[model samples]
Target: MSATASTQRPRLGVTFWLLAVALVALYAILVPILAALYGVSVPVAFLLGAGMCAAPLLALWYPRSSVAVFTVAAFVLPLTVSPDRDPVWPWPWSVPALILFALFVLTLTMQHGWRLGSLALLLGLMGSLAAPLLLPDAASAGAAGADLIVTASIATVAFVVGVLLAGRIRLGAELTREREHAEFERSRRELVEERTRIARELHDVVAHSMSLIQVQASTARFRAPGLPDEAIAEFDSIAATARSSLTEMRRILGVLRTEDHTAELAPQRGIDDIPALVDSTRRAGAPVDLTHEVEGEISAAVQIAVYRIVQESLSNAVRHAPGSSIGVSVTTAGDDVQVVVRNTPVPPSDPGTPGHGLRGMTERATLLGGEIHADRDGDGWTVSARIPRQPAATEVSATASTSTSTTTTTTTTTTEGSA
Candidate 1:
């Protein structure tokens, strides 16, 4: 139970005890007074009254024991009336018995649900009807057959009503819970549909534009007559870069277009592609100094995360801090790979604003059970990431490794010449 519900229990207990005490006091006074009027002994009347109150008193503390307690009280009540009386039944106690019966039904239903409460109600009705047979004065008593029938009928009606009401209450609560859950699921599905729609729109616009740029750049290199070799080379480089971006964009769009999460497509770029990334940044007019001291082969997932972090950091620097010298480093310490990218601060004309790139980098690192930190470092900005490296299940081929190494060397030489 919640704290508020737990605290209310004591208050409820106090209220029940107070109500039980008041009812017992009323019974104690009334029964003895009526017996005195009938010429019965004061002691016997008070004792019987006390006995009558015992079940309800026990019910105040042990509410679950109510059925057993009421059964005993029902059997004992009839024995209290005088044999010489015209009406041998103790009809005055009938009101108290009805009150106790109602209390038992309500408490049992609330605590144990309808099934047990209905059982207790059935037992209570039977016990009440059988009470007359336990009377010490039964041999001289007047017929109570009509009275018994009326009382039993009334109790049965009340029990049916109580059961129906309890069933309705439980059904309503269950429906409310199911409705809330369905609403949550509906909202979640709508959110996913909205995301898919946005992704498709972005793919249509950006991918088409990039593809057109690549085609135009390639066409310009061959179509233009007497063009300088340098200009043709620059155009070729632009086409290559655009083609690379289109490939990456398609990979991302493929993920967005499909609902099947386990669907696989082309392989992704990773750490081996970082040299090309740096070369592209250099071609875009930002000088980058690259360094690495990694020892063992890292998983493709970790390599991809590291490469993306570096790529985004460099892209941000080029956009917001043009003409700034950037430094990139990757080093491994035991089982962890560390990446640091730092660039000179942007001029006053290119003031920084928080964007999605930083958040994406952070999310990537966190997904790999790692962390990234980006902050202003004196006159520059620095991004640092630490990713735990897991071993790959299989080793990459020697041919692929040699090709990547040669590409890295050529890219480094080109970056040095441009610098």
Candidate 2:
């Protein structure tokens, strides 16, 4: 699981094809010459040289086994080859075999690690070196002097070179993995830092203003002379609502409360608070008629979105159409919560452009796997939202959900948008 899985076998590249061709040429050219010099049948010479050529390729799968076969053939061939054949070609070990044996040692060393390769080098040298001793007169190059040295040197060099190259390849691969891991960690750290910065800024600016509002509202009764009981209660409600908003904002930003501040853990306003909202708006000058019909359990996220959308709609209606009767309805249909708010139609007093409040409502509805549609009806502007009862796993679900309301002007722009 640490590495990505490969589904198919890798294809052999051009390097492998070229190596195979070189091995075949060695077989075709050397077999006839070896047969003539070995003083043996063509089949015998072919078989002996074949093991040397095949050993390098087979070393990929069975390194020790190929080494054993190559060693046996190397030992037997020197004894069978005629002593008086030729002095020009290397004695005991032919040139083709010398090349092939070195290749075998290199392949074994790289693929199977240096331990097995060291063992193979020792075994190969043993058979080739002992051939001259066994048939002292058959050493066409003066009794195992130069030929023995040549074979031993070639093998040792191959092993040493193979070890160095293999180590380099392994080091490079390890470095690549380490670099990728470091980059991933750095990106994650940057994301966390950015989120913290955003939260701090919001707390410094927005939290400060809300704190002032709550304090002023809470102390209004003391500042005013002989305030009525109902007026005092309304100011207290405003203070309590402000405090609740501050607590919720802190929770959302994941900011810890200080020693002077206590975590309120207040519940958000939901369906039950709609009547109070209507009453407050009526007191503000806009008369609102509200009806509620909720069924099944609704997620806190969906409830909050519904409440905000309603709150914003009412505020817009009151601001733009004071004394106008606003109709608000909350109901559930199967797996969704439905909200509809309609305000009395009036020729838009301002330019019919979408405002921040309208955008906020659209964003809230869209945040939970929901859609909001705000358009003009014959009588007035209607702002409706359909949000799922259960919250979605991610905001991706919100994007996937359908919505016609991107940013409608709502109550402020009655001529062009919804309320």
lDDT of 1: 0.62
Q: Across residues 84-164, which tens digit of lDDT does each residue of candidate 1 receive? A: 665644342355555555655655555446776677677666765565666534433345555555556655565666677
Question: For each candidate, what is the lDDT?
Answer: 0.62, 0.68
Provide the lowest-lDDT 10-residue window in model 2.
Answer: 257-266
Q: Per-prediction RMSD in angstroms?
A: 15.6, 15.7
Candidate 2 lDDT tens digits, 1-419: 11221211132244356667888988887788788765656777888888888887667656677888988988887777766666566777788888888888887887667998898888888888877778877645463678778878988899999898779767976898799999998896656655544553355345545655665566667657689999999999998998799778868666532222111111255665666666655544345677777756776556656777787777556545544578888888898889999987645663343434465566567767688998777757788999887756564332233221212112211111111
Looking at model 1, residue 366 earns an lDDT score of 71
**After best superposition, candidate 2 residue 80: deviation in angstroms?**
4.9
Query: Which ranges of candidate 2 are over 4 A from the true structure?
Result: 1-15, 60-62, 79-89, 110-113, 133-137, 202-419
| Top candidate when judged by TM-score against the true structure | 2
TM-score of 2: 0.47
